[model samples]
Target chain A: MIPTIKNSKWLPLCDVPVLDPSSWRQVIVQNVREGDRIAALFGCTHNASVPVRLYALLARDGQGTLSVLCTDVEKDYPSLTPECPQAHWFEREIFEQWNIIPQGHQWLKPIRFHAPYASSTKTSPPIGEADFFQLLGNEIHEVAVGPVHAGVIEPGHFRFQCHGEDVYHLEISLGYQHRAIEHSLIGGPNKRTLPYMETLAGDTTVGHTTAYCQLVESLAGCTVSSPLLRLRAIALECERLANHIGDLGALAGDVGFLPTASFCGRIRGDFLNLTAELCGSRLGRGFIRPGGVAFELDTSAFHGICERLTSVSHDARSAIDLLWNTASVVARFENTGTLSQAAARDLGLVGLAARASGVKIDVRKDFPCGAYADEPFPVQWGEKGDVYSRAYLRWLEILQSIHFIIDKQERFVPNAVQTQIGNLQPSSLAVSLVEGWRGEICHVGLTDDQGKFAHYKIIDPSFHNWFGLAMAMRNQLISDFPLCNKSFNLSYCGHDL
Target chain B: MIKSLWTRLKQHHRTIAFPKQEPRLPEKFRGLPSIVQSRCPKHCSECVTSCPTDAITMKDKQPHWDLGRCLFCPECSRACPHGAVLFTDDYRMATRTRDNLVIGPKEYGLAQPLEDQRRKLFGKSFKLRVVSAGGCNGCEVETNVLETIVFDIGRFGIGVVASPRHADGLIITGPVTHNMKSALEKTYRAVPDPKVVIAVGACAISGGPYIDSPVANNGVGNLLSVDLYIPGCPPHPLTILDGLLRLLGRRYSTSRR
Candidate 1:
C-alpha cells in the first residue's frame, strides 16, 4: 500500500521513511497507474554527506488522499514518464534543480531555463536558446512569434511548423520571466515571503498567497478562525470570478464578438472592485497573511459585497449569454483547437482546462479544506474539449462561483479574524493545495532543524496546463491559435516562477 | 442587433472625467505615502523593519520612502505607533524622473511635461508600445484596462500601438529578468529618437518583491533611461492615466483639493 498522508498534515521530514531507488520507482509507478496524479515531485538536501532526497506527493483524486513517498538519489533514477506521462515535467524539473538525471526520459529538456540551485559543475545554457523539435518537409514553413509580442502581454516564444494554414506542430518556449522566486524563497518566511507569494503570479495573488499561508500556518500549527476561513474562500472565489469574466471577455474578443468583449472587460473590474472593497488592493493583496486574513469583513462590508455581487452576476450572465446566442462566435469556438480527453489525462491537466476536456478533478471538492470542506460546490465539466468548451466552462464556473460566494456570505459566522502563529515545527513538511483561478496551486514547505524553510516548491496550475495548450494546437489552423491560447490563458510568470 | 444597440444605449458612459473631476477611489486604497518627520521617535526603526521591500530607509535623519520600491502594502503605516508613515489617496504619483519617486518630508513636484518641442510633436498623438519584461500580468492587465471602455486612454490620443516603431514612447512593466534583458534593450533601441520610457508598477520601478533575486536585474531603470516612474504594486488604472496625462502636459481640469 502507498503511504498516504492527509492534506496539511505536518510530519517530521526524517520520519518519511526513504526507500531504495528501485523500490521507490516501483511504488511511484504503481500508484500513478492506479489513477493517482503527481501533484508535486521535488528534491531537497539537508547535509553535504547525504544524497538529495526526492519527495513525490501522489494525489489520488477519487480517494481524496495524498500519498507522500520519498527516496534518496545520488545521480540518476529510472524515468516514470513511460508509464506515467504526467511525471514528465516534474522529472525534468527535478533534473534541472538537482542534476539527478531521469534515465530513459525521451525528451529531457530544461523546464525553466535557470541555473541549478546549488553550485554545479554543469554549465547553464541561456534561456530560450535550447534546441526545439523541428519538422522538415518540402512545403512546411516555420513561424516564430515572441518572447515579445504585439499585445500588452507577457513574454514567451512560440514556434509553429505550418503547412499553409494548418499548424502541424507547435512548441512553446518560456522562462523569459524567470525571477528565481523558488530559490529566493529558501530560508524565508520573512516579511518578503508573503509579498513574494502575493506577486508569484500577480493575477492569482489571493490564490497563491492563500496556498502559501496555508502551508505556513499548517507548519506553524496555527488554527485559523471560521470567519477568516469564510473570508478567504470568498476572496478566492472573487478572484476566480474576475479572472473567469476577463477570460470569457478575452475569448469573445478573440472571436471578434464586440458586445460581450467590451462589456465583460468593464464587468471584470466590478469583481475586482468588490475585492478592493474586501481589502485595499483590487487583486486581493494584503488581504491574506500567514496566520490568518489581515482584513475583516464587517456587516456593512458584507452587505456591500452582496449588493455588488448580485448586480455583477446579472451583468456577467447577460454579457456571456450573448456569446452562446451568436452564431459566428459559436462557429469559431466549437471544434477548434480540440484537446482529446485522453491527451488531457495523459498530460496531467488540472483545473478548468482539464475540466473542459471532461476530466472531473477539482482540488476544493476532492481534497476539501477549510471553507471548501464545509461549503461544498459541485464540480463542473464539459465534453467537447474545444475552445468553446473551455470558454463555456469558465462561464459556468463564474455563475457557480457567484452562487457559492452568496451562499457563504449568507451563512458566514462571526469569529476572530486572526490567531497568533507559533514557531514552525522543526524538520517538518507541509503540503497545501488551493484551487486558484487558473487551477490547482500546490505549495510544499519543508523546514530544516532550525525551523527555516529548506525547500519551498510552488507548482502553479499553469505549469501543468501550458503543455495542454500546446497539445491542443496540434493539427489546428494557425489562425485559431490565438483563440485557443486565450482560452487557456496560462500564466508565463507563474510557470517561470 | 436592436437589443445590442439598446443595451449599449442604456449603459452609462463608463469613462471617468478625471482632472476635470476626482476619480472615485476606495477608502482603503493606498497611493502616495507621506512621512511625518516629527512623529518618528529617534532610534525607532519600526517602519524600516516592517517594510518588506526595503522601500523605507533613513536619509538625512528623516524617513525616506521610495514609491518605486514600495508594494503599497501599508505595513509601514500600521507598524508606526506614532503615525510617522502614512499613505494618502493621492493617485497623482507619477513623475518625470526616478529621483522624484523618492518621497521624504519635503514636498516633491509631480511629473513635468516633456520639452516644448517634443510636447508639440507628440502630445496630441502620444502612441506607446508596452513591453512586459517579466511583469506578473497585474501591471499588464491594468495597462490593458487603459484601452477598455471605462478608462479609455485613447481619448487623449495616448494609445498603445502594436509595434515599437509605431510608438512615440514605451511603457515598461516588471522587474527586468536576465532572460528578458536583451529583448528589452532591443525593444528600447527599436523605438525612434526622442522617445520616452515610462516604468509602471513597483516591479518595473524597483523590482518590487523580487528585488534581490539573482535572475532579475531589478527594474527597467537599471538598463534604460526611464523618463517616468508610476508607482504602485500595480498602479491603479486611474493613477497610470493621471501620470501619463501629466507627463504629456495635458490636463482635463485643475487639481482637486
Candidate 2:
C-alpha cells in the first residue's frame, strides 16, 4: 500500500521527500507497473542555480488517492522511458523545458519548440522544424499536413509515413499555438491568472477553471458550500455536454451522416446557450472563481434552467439517436482506428479515450472531490477502443451528465455562492483534478513563503492522451484520418500549453 | 430513414431571423459597455486598476476604454462605484478603423462597410481563411459555429474556404504567437489582391489576456492592415455575424435592447 493524498488537497512542500535519481526511477517504474497511472510528471526550479526538482503524481484509481514522489536532478538523469513506456512524453517534455538530458530517451525532440528555461529565447529553433521518425523503404512515402489546416481549427503539423493507403506511422509536431501559459503563472495568481485558466483550453472554460479554482481554494484552506459546489459541477457538466454533443455531430459529419450532424450542430448551441443564460458567456467564462462560483442560480433562474435542460435533453436524444439507428454510420465507426485495451493502459491514457478502451479511470468516481464527493456518477466505459466505442461512450456520458445535472439541481439550496479567498498557506502544494469533458484535468499549485505561486502546472487531458491518438493511427487507413482524428478531438493549444 | 426525417422535423427552423428580426440574447450576456464619464468620482481609477489586460487607462484623469483590448469580463463593471461603466447587450461593437475602437463618452460609429471599391469586389461572395495562430479555440469555435444551422453564415455568401488561394481575405484569431507569426504572414500573402483582414476576439485585436507576454505579439493589427475588429474575449457568434454583415454593407436591424 502506498501513502497518498485526496484530490484537491494540499500538503507542506517539504513533506514531499526528495529521492536519488535511481530510486526515483525505480519507484515510478514499479508503481506504474502495478497499474497506477501518472497523473502529472514535471520539473520545477526556482532559479537556474537550483537543480530541477522532478515531481511525479501517480493516481491510484482503485484506492481513490494520488501518490506523490520527488527527485532532484542537476543536469542529467537516466531515462524512465525504457522501463515505463508511459513516461515517454513526460521525459521528452522535461528534456525540452529544463535541458536536463534524459540520457537514454530513445527519441529526444522539442515538444513545444520553445527555448530551454536556462537558455536564451533567441537560440530556440523554429516551430515544426524537428526530426521525425522515418521508415526507409521503396514504397514508404511521407505526407505532411498543417500548422495551417484547411478548416477553422488550431494549427499543428502532422507527418505520416504511408505505404499506399495504409498509415505506417504518424508523427505529430505541435507548438504552433503555445502562448507560454504555465510559464506566465509563476510568482503570482493575479487577475491575469483566472482569465489564463479560463482560456487555457477555450472549449473547456468551466472544466479547467474549476480545476484552477479548486486548487486555489484548497491552498487557501477554504470550503465551498454544497450548493455552490453543485453549481460549479453544473457549469462543468454543461461544458461537457456542449463539446461532447458537438464532437458527436462532427464525427457524424465525417461519416457523411447529415441528419445527426446538422441536428447536433444546432443542438450543441442550445447547451452552450444554457450555460450563457447562467454565466453571461456562451463558454461559461465568468461563472467560476476561487472561493466559489461567481454567480448563483435563484429559484426562478433555477426553474428556467431546468425547463431549458428538459427541452434540450429531448432534442439531443432525437438528434443523437439517429446515429445509432443508421447502419451506414454505425458500420463506418466500428473498429476504425482501434486501440487495444493493453495499449491504452500502457500509454496511461485518460478520459473518454481511456474509458473507450475499458480503462476505469474517472477522476469523479476514483478521486471524488467538490460536488462529485457528495454525489458520484457511475463510471461509464467501453470494451473495444474503436471509433464506435469512443462515439458510443460519449452518448452514454452525455446521458449520465444530463441526469446528474438535473439531480443535483433538484437538491440545490439557496445560499451565499461565493466567499473571499484569503492568502494561501505558505510553502504548500495542492493538486486538483477535474474530469473534464475530455478526461482528467490536473492542476498542481505550489505556494511560496509569501503565499504567492512558486509554480503552477496544468496537465490538460490532451497531454496524456495525444500519444494514444498517434498509436491508434498505426496500420490505419490514411483516408480515415479525419474520422479517427475527430473521435479523439484532442486540443492543440491545450497540448502546446 | 423515417427516424432521420422525424428527427429533422423535430429540430425545425433553428436559424435566427437576424437583421430582419433581432435574436433574443440572454439578459446576462455581456456585450458593449456604455461609459458614463460624468458619473465617475474625482481621481477614481477603479476600472483601470481592476482591468486585467489594462484595456482601461486613465487619460487626463478620466477612464478611457480600448474595445480592442477588452475581454468584457465583469471586473470593470463591478469595480465602478458610480455605475459609470455598464455593459449593455449591444453586440454590434465591431469597428472598421483601429482609432474607432478606443471609446470615450460619446457613441462611436459601428463598423463601416469597406471602401466602395473593396465592397464591390467582395459584396456578393466572400471567402476567408481563418488562421488560429495561438487562440484557445474560443474564437475559432464561435467562428465555426456561424456555419451551423442557427447562424448559417453561408446564407450571407460568407464562407471559410480550405485554402488561402481560394479566399478573398483572411479572418485571424489568437494573439499571434512568435511561432505562428511567419505562418500568418505567409497565409496573408497567399491571398490575391484587394483582400480584407478581419481580426476577431480580443486576442487577435490586442492580445486579450496574453498581452505583453514575451511569446505573443499584441495582435494582427501590428503585423497587417486589419479592416474590421470584433471585440470580446471570444466574440459571440452573433457579434461575429453582425460584424461580417455590417462590413459587406448588408442591411441589418440595429435595435438591440
Candidate 3:
C-alpha cells in the first residue's frame, strides 16, 4: 500500500497545539470515548520528558486505516484503547516506556523490558516492566519456550497462553538480548556504532547498517553518489542472496534433507567469499560510508562476481528443484502457520511475512530508496501468507536479485567517488525504507537544532510483525513452529533494539 | 541415486585449501595488525592524519597502535611515502597481551615482519578457534566455508569453534556489544589460558564501523586483550587462512598479519 502523504504546512488533525521543540506547555486534554481513536498523522507531540516522538493515528472510520492523534493526554488525558482496539499495544508500549498514563487504560503489561529498567530511560521514564504486557486470565495456560533452541538461531523468548491446542491469548516477552543500543549511542555514536548495528542480528547486517548509515548521512546532510547507490544495492542484493540460500537449505533440512541443506550452506560460503573478494570484510561492513560507499568495484572484481553469479545461479536452481520435488520437504512446508491478510495488516506486518499474505508494500517498490529506485523489478507478493508461500517468495526474490546483479555487472562502468556531502538543514526530517531480506525496513531521524541527530528510531520489519507471528501460531500444531518461524525468519535482536 | 551422485559430482567444491595451497586474497585484504620492520618510521606524521578512526597515537615519539582500534585497511601504508606499511602474509596474529601491538614511531617493537612472528609462535603446529561475536556473519560464513570441500581450513588443522572451550586460540568478528559481554567473556574463559585471542575484521581489531555503540565501552579493547588485529569489515577468506598458518608457526609474520 502507498504511504498516506500529508503536507504539514496547514493545521494538523491533532487537537493539541503542536508544541515547539523547546517548549513543554500547551497540553490539550480530551477524553476518548469507547470507540473513539485519537490519530495524528502530520506532526506528533515530542515528549520532552522522554527521548521519543509520539504520533497518534485515531481510527475515526470503521475501516482499517487509523485516524490522526487527537489530543495531548498527560495529567488530563483520556484512554483511546476503549475506542480503538489496535491502539491497545501501541499505547501500552508508549505508557510503559515513557511513563505516560492513558487515564482509564485497561491493560498495561510489559512488552519488551524484562526488569522495567535495564538502565536509565532518558527517552521516557518507563511504567516499570511489570505493567506493560497483558495480564493472562486464570484459565490461560502460560507456555515458555526458549531463549535458546536446538537449531541454529539467535536468542529470544516466546510465551503462549492456550486453552488446549489453540491459543486463547498470547503475550511475547522479549529483551533477553537488549544491548541498550539507543542508550549506548548516547555516549559514543560514531563509526564504532556502525558495526554494532550489524550484530543487532546476524542475518540483517547489510539492512541494519544501511539504515543506520542512511540516517547518519542524512543527519550530516551527506548525499552519496549514484555509483555508491549502485554499490549499496549490489551489496544488499548479495546479502539477500546469502540469506535466501540459507533459508532454502534450512527449510529443506527441517524435513531431513541433509544433502540439499549441506549444498545450500556451502553455496552460502561461496557467497561470503564473493563478498570478501570485492570488499575487505565479509559481511559488507565498512563498505557503506556516510557520503557513499568506502570501496569501489573495479573491472577484475566485477568479472569475478559475474563468473561466480553465473555458476551459482545454475547450481541454486537445480538444488532448489531437488528439495522442492521431495515429498517430505513439500509436505512439511505446505499449509503451516497461515496468517490471513486481515490479521497481517492489523498487526502492521511488513516484509516477506506480510508479502506472503499478499501485501504489496516493499520499501524498494513502494518507496524506492538507493539504486533500487532506478532498478526495474516488481515487488514479490504471495497469494497466501503461510510457511509455504513465504519460503517460495524468498526464493523468487533471490532469483530476481541475481538477475539484478547480473544486469548491473554486465553494463557497469566505474565513476569518480564523491567525497563531500551536503550540509543537513535542521528543519527537515527524511524517512526512507529499504526492502531488506526480511521485509520493509524503515529509518526515521530527527535532526537537532544543530543538524545533528536529535533522535533516531530504526523501525525494522521484525518489530511490526512479532504480533503477527503469535497470531500465525494460533491453532497450528506446536511441532510446526520451527518451519513457521523460519518462513517468517524475524530477527530477534532487530526487534529487541 | 544416480542423479544425486551426478549433482554431487557436478557441483564444484566450495572451499579453497589456503595453507597447503595458495588461496587468492583481495589486493588490500586487511587481516591483522603487525609492524613493518622494512621501513621503520623516522617520526613522520603522515599516517596519523590518514587514520580515520584515530586509533593511532604517538607516545614518546613512537606510534602506539591499539589493535582494538586500528582498522587494517592498509590505508596507513598507502599514506606512507616510504611504503613502511607492508602487507605481510602473516595471518595468525593473536596474543594474550592487550598491549601486543606496538604504538609510537620508535617503539613499534617490530624486530621483524608479522611473518617472522607467526614463524616464531607456531614453529610448525597450531590449533585455532574462530569466534564470530556479532560478526556480520561474513567472516563466520567464509570461515565456515573453510571447512567445506573448497577452502578447507581443517586441512591445516584450523577450524571455527562455536564455543571457546575446545580452542587454543580465538578469532573474533564484529564490534563487541554489552549484551555479548558475558558471552565474549565466557568464550574467552572457555578457552584455556596461555591461549591467544586474534581480533579478526576491522570491527574486532577496532570496531570497524560500529565503534560508537552505546553498549560498546569500546569494541574489542573493552572485551579482551586482543593479540592480533586484522582489518577489513570482513577480512578476505585467504587472509584468514594465512593468519591461521602464521599462528601455527607454519608461515612468517610480515608487517600486516
Candidate 4:
C-alpha cells in the first residue's frame, strides 16, 4: 500500500497507522534510502494517558505523494540520524519539544533553547550557552558573533572554529527570535493566527500566509475562487522577486561591486511597492486571510501594475546582469561556499538552496497546488552548489517569477475575493506545502474534536537549509562567512518559531 | 566600466525628494485610523470583537482604538457596520508617549521632537544602533530600508553605527523576548548618557501580536524609557522616516492637505 494522501486534503486523524518504533524507523529509513524526503517530523503529546506520539510526514517528490506514519514512545527511541542524515535537525527538534531522546544521535543539543514542551520540570539551558564544538590546536582559535549583530538584522549566535583565516566549522545557535508562535498557536485560527502567519518570517508574508490559509481551507473544505488564486500567486511571486533582488544586491555589495548593489537596493523597493499597491502593507500583511484575500486588484489598476512591473523588470535585469559580467564579483562568489549535491540531498535541503546545489526538487513542480497547478513554470536550477550558483540561481528564479506573475495577471479574471470559511472538520489532519522564496514552507495542522488546533507544526525552509550553510562554510575563508551567510539568507525567527 | 556607467544612467538617480516634496503612498495603503463614534449604533461592540490584538476596547459602549496594539488589519474595519472605524492614508502615527497611543475617536499627539538638550545633541549627525530583540524582521527590514537610496536617511545626517558605544541612540524592534532581554539591556547600557531610544513598529511599542506571550514581554514596555513610538504591524519606511525627522524637529508638511 502507498499509505499516501494527496496534498491539502484532510484525513481522519485515526486513519494514520501507528507502528512500533522499530517498524517506524524501518519505514522511514527504507523510504529515505529509496529517495523519499522527510517533509515534517514532529510529536504530539495530546493524550496524557498515552505516550508522546511521533508523526513522520514523508514526501516522495517524483511521485507527488506524501505518507504519514506514527509511533508512540515513552522516552527514548533509537536514533534515525545514524541511518538517515536528513532527520538530524528534525530529531533534535523532536527531542527539544517532547523530551523524547533519540539515543545514539551524533550531535544532540537544543535546536531552540526552550524547555521541553512535554515537561517543564527541569531548568532549560540559556540561549547561547550550549557547548559548541571547538578545536584545540596550536594555531586554532574561536570567534563568536551575535545574538546582537552589527547590522540591522535578526538575532542568532554564530561560532566559528578557525585555524588562522580558514574556517574548520561554523555552528549557529538560535532561539533569540523565538516569539513562542507555535506555542501560542494551540487552539487557534483565532485573530492572532493570521497575524502570526503573516509575520512568521516577515519577508515571506504571502507564502506563509497562503500556506496557512490552504491548511484552513482544506480542513474547512472551502474552495478559493480562480481570480483569488491568481492574485495570491502574483503576490507570492512579487515577494520572491523582492527578496531575491534584495539578496542579490546585498551579495554584490559584499563583493565590493557598487553599481549593481546600489541599483538593486532601490529596485527591491520598487517591487515591494508593487505589493503595497496590491494591498496596504509593503510586506503583503492584511492582503491574505483565511477564506481568501483581503483586497482585490481592479481591472483598471492591472494596466498600471503591469507597466510598473515591466519597468522594474527592466531595471532588475540591468542591475543583475552587471554582477554576471563583472570578473571581480564572479571570482569572489565562484567557489566560496560549495555544498555537494550528494551532501545537499543527505541534508534534505529545499527551495532555491537545494536547486542551486543541483537537487531537482520543487514543491510547485513536484506537488502542484492552487494557481501553480494551472500555471506551472519551469524550475530554474544550477549545478555548482556554490555561492556563484546560489547567486545566479536567484536571478534565474526571479526571471521565472516575473514572467509567471505577468502571465497570470494578463489572463486575470474578476471574481469574489473572499468566501465564508466555515468551521473546520473535527478530528482531522491537513498538510500544506508552499514554495516560499526561501524554500518549502510546510504547515501541518491536527485539529481536536471541537475543530480547534491540537498541534500545528510549521517547518520553514531555514530549518532544513541552516545546516547546509554551516556545511558550506567548511574549509572556506572565515572572512567569506558573511558572503556565504547572505547567500543562504536563512531566517532566525522562522527557525526559532 | 562603460557598461557600468550606462547602467547607472539608465537606473537614474532613484532617490525621492520626500519631506520637501510630499511622499506618495499607494491608494490602498492603510495608515493612521480614525473612529467616528457618532455613526456607531448603541451597544455595538462589533469592532472590539473583531480586533485580533484587542487593539479596540469598548468602554461605556465607545470604541477606543489603540494604534500601538493594532496590526492595521481589515477585520475591524469590515466588521464596523457604521463605518465608525476607518484607516486614513495618514502615516504620521508615531507618538512621543505610550498613553497617546490609546485614543477614542479623537485627535492624538504625533511624535514630538526630543526635548531641546537631546535634539541639539543629536540634531546634526545622529547615529543609532538597531537591536532586534525578538522582532519578526518586518520592523527591522523597514528600519534598514531607511538607509536605501530611495529614502536615503543619511541625507539628514542620521546613520546606523556598528556598535552601541558610538551611537547617540538605539532603534529597537521586536516584543523583547526573554532570551533577548539581557542582550537588549546590555546594548542599552553600552550607549552613553543622554542617549535617545526610538521604538519602531507596533511590536516594539506594545508587543503587537505577541503581547502577553509567555516567552516574550510587551516589547520594551517599561523596561526602558522610550522617546518615540512608531506604530504599524511594520511601519512603512516613510512612517519611520517621519518619526525620526519629527524627533529632530525637522518638520515638513507630511500629506497633501
lDDT per residue as tens, model 4, B1-257: 99999988999887899888777899988988877757888588888888988998877777788889999988888898888778888888888999888877556778778889998999988999999988689998899888899999999999999999999999999999989999999999999999999898888888988999888889896799999999998999988998899999997454456
Instruction: List model 3 lDDT by residue over B43-160, tens digit each.
Output: 8867767775676776665556765466555456657787766555444444434455544443333222234555455444455655444434445554555565566555665655
Regarding DockQ, does 2 or 3 come out ahead?
A: 2
Interface RMSD for all numbered candidates: 1.2, 0.9, 4.7, 0.8
- Which of the predicted structures, 1 or 4, would earn the higher TM-score when compared with the native? 4
lDDT of 1: 0.86
- Native contacts present in each candidate (fraction): 0.74, 0.87, 0.21, 0.85
In order of the candidates, what TM-score does chain B achieve?
Answer: 0.94, 0.95, 0.62, 0.96
Off by over 4 Å in 1: A413-415, B36-39, B252-255
DockQ of each: 0.77, 0.86, 0.23, 0.87
Q: Note the Cα lDDT for every prediction shown.
A: 0.86, 0.89, 0.59, 0.90
lDDT of residue A270 for candidate 4: 91
When only chain A is evaluated, what TM-score does every model earn?
0.98, 0.98, 0.81, 0.99
Instruction: Report the C-alpha displacement of residue A41, candidate 2, in angstroms.
Output: 0.9
TM-score of 1: 0.98
Clashing pairs in 1: none
Q: For candidate 2, write residues A288-338 as lDDT tens digits.
A: 988887766786787788889989999999888888989999999998999
Candidate 4 has which clashing residue pairs, if any?
none
Predicted structure with the largest DockQ when compared to the true one: 4
